[model samples]
Target: MATRARGRGSGRHDGQPGHGRHTTATARPARTRNPLVTAPGTLATPADRALRGKAARTRVPRSAHASWLPSVDRPDPVAVLERQGRDRLPELLPIRYGRMAASPFAFLRGAAAVMAADLAAAPHTGLTVQLCGDAHLLNFGLYASPERALLFDLNDFDETYPGPFEWDVKRLAVSVAVAARENGHPEAKAGRAAQEAVTAYRTAIRRLARLGELDVWYTRIDAEQLLPLARSTRHRRRAESSLGRARRRTSLQAYGKLTEVVDGRRRIIEDPPLIEPAGTSDMAFLRKIFSDYRSTLSEERRLLLDRYRFVDAARKVVGVGSVGLRCFIVLLAGRDADDPLFLQIKEARQSVLEEHLPSGPYVHHGHRVVAGQRLLQAASDIFLGWMTGPQGRAFYWRQLRDMKGSADVAGMSPADLVSYARLCGTALARAHARSGDRIAIAGYLGNADTFDRAVTAFALSYADQTVTDHATLGAAVAAGLISAAPGV
Candidate 1:
């Protein structure tokens, strides 16, 4: 590993000196549970048609972008995927793991281009905004601001780009539909979740139209805070338990594996093929770079005058969809072992926004990642910065996990799903509204149902198509075309 000319102690309980909301005006701010939604039973017949049509030509409505290259009508589903797997998958791997959990919808996540291509095939209402392209079910989560105050917001930026705002909503709603299917909910009920989500988004945007811009920026929607809104005792309790757990998370909670420490000579225990330690020399260079990391931060942010130094670093695989990617967590120490700060630097691959988007090089795609993350997130990592790695790769750096948390879809019931989906929709709207113009989009949506119905139709259609693709993936696995864990 190369070095960054900056330094900070690792294993600190809270965060780096000034991450998240503590920073001045900059960047902002997956999974479903269940397995029984059948394409024939859950999706409208048209969705199956969508699943089947991968080669059809499509177009974006004139009002949306005034651009000519991208179209909305979809191609045959089978063929669309053939092109994606051949052309896109090779590049996106080392993708965030954990995202491709044990479901078809989960698998779709690791394949962002596949999702983008599928989304491109859907109908649009011409409403656009900067979108967090990979807004899957599990993506929204809670994280501490530099103040250590926790807030719920978008947590991933690998696919951030400007596009039809509806693309994010459609992707989000369809995820609800698929997750509902997985849960064996009736298709009608699943459709309701999708409907509720869009309605919430529409309503949230309109609500923002009434608030001052700064208010929008300062507003933090938190999950624990929603417990009061919970109508049922069950939801309230769950929310409380979840919040309690989140509030309790500290650096000590995360650094349990490496117990043997003397002079901060820690050893990270190997978790099999998943998280084995690299060579000793490899770690030394990583430490050397930790000292260099301090220079990477703006001098203003590089305060505290060196109370810490880098001690240990290791390779760690995390997130379902992001499992194979090059992810490293460097543990730092200042004055003592307990005062540690853990910084993770993950490789940022090209966005799916690249191939489908109008051609132009993203001068600083890493900068774009940092900027988009700051824009969309309520708070961000203190050490958040971008760097170029060896062998021509780009990476964005941040704290390993400071009071980081997420809503667990696996544990949610339908009513919980409804409330959570609404929360996500509302948050997504706020993110878009803050990053772009709420009025223009609201004007495009008008006091009408055109945007709602079009995307609802599209979400249902694409979800049906996703199941077919999932089956194809299953077949490919069966035939050894690709590989994943058996019974996955």
Candidate 2:
């Protein structure tokens, strides 16, 4: 079970340095329950919730979030990454390092653990939410909902957990700053872009707070609704093209690109070190786990799944932080060979945020991820599920591609980045509003830009720290302390 936020003046009991320290406030009756699991009719009134939020500010001031000095005992970023890779595939560690070393933004993408540690060191608003723990800029994207509507929302939940709402906001803001700087924008523009994200979040939360429960829960950002936000003809055209491309990114597309006929059967094409034929034992393991995975789906989804027969499976590498983990792609054919379905089975480890926050209400990491995705996403894939594989390893299953697309942050202009950042911010707030105390959070934010400015300042400072960390990783690779396979 997760621990509840302590009342003011309770002091820290988690044993982490600089955690849960409130400067000026009185203790209230401690609500020792997971905030996400409250019973219906048990929640406080809107006014009371708002007052609770305002009280949090007296403990952790809005201005306090601006500071970003690294402690003398701060863990070496490279060492922190190395520790995460200790249980992963040894041959793939170089790829993860090489990818992260490409740029500071890239480093930030793969260094969730490093950032989680940093965020934990600071005092935060106890306004808790089911965080999109890796809420960086690229992680927000367009995906087809079950109704086949294109919706823009957070697409990653590998590190999702119940934590201070500001943690996700801070990470998103920092990503915007880093991305703006990487695109050659001036520091002032970068800071403004970061602030745009926080501003959108603040306003969105405040609006959501005024809404009824069902209204907040049903809120979504439709992709079609985003077209009007494109200020330039070129950007609108680009947005339309991206959305069109995402619509075409289905199982049929993967079949055309990733498989070919062998004898009378379709087989996955081998691309060694990235995509390879699963060995005999691996194939047997997956086949056994297939039943286990199928049991996790709903009855209707199971019925839908039963119509398909497995065609091929391949061990595939994916993502920066996820590169070294065990991941596989399974191809299934329905009705005819032309009717294909591709499902990805990715390994799920304990989240990086788990170490910093109280225990999450999940023993299986895969279940944690799947539950988080279901709770946070406005609309989720029908095929999302989880199971325990061999050796008690947890794995989550989902469609390899269901009209999924992400913005190209590197190519974005300054204004384009700010608009996109705000869009991401809006999407994130909708997700948080569904699971957190929005009234309290809104009360904390008030109607001012104080939190926005402070977080923007923190984002700029953190971007600087990220650049230094990227250089450190580059140095390690150059000194042969760590191997890197660039351009992989």
Question: Model 2 — which ten-residue stretch has the worst lDDT?
Answer: 1-10
TM-score on alpha carbons, each prediction: 0.77, 0.94
**What is the C-alpha lDDT profile of model 2 across 1-488, one tens digit per residue?**
01111123322323223552222222321236644334765866778788888988877788667778887778999999999999999999999999999999999999999999888776667788899899999899999999999999999999999888999999999999899998999877888899999999999999999999999989999999989988889888998999999999999999999999999788999998899999999899889999888898999999999999988999999999898999999999999999999999999998988777666689999999999999999999999999998889999999999999999899999999999999999999999999888989999999988889878887888888999999999999999999999889
Per-model clash counts, in order, read 66, 0
Residue pairs in candidate 2 whose N, alpha carbon or C atoms collide under 3 angstroms: none
Q: Each candidate's lDDT (Cα)?
A: 0.61, 0.88
| Predicted model with the maximum TM-score | 2
Q: Name the lDDT value of residue 269 in candidate 2.
A: 98
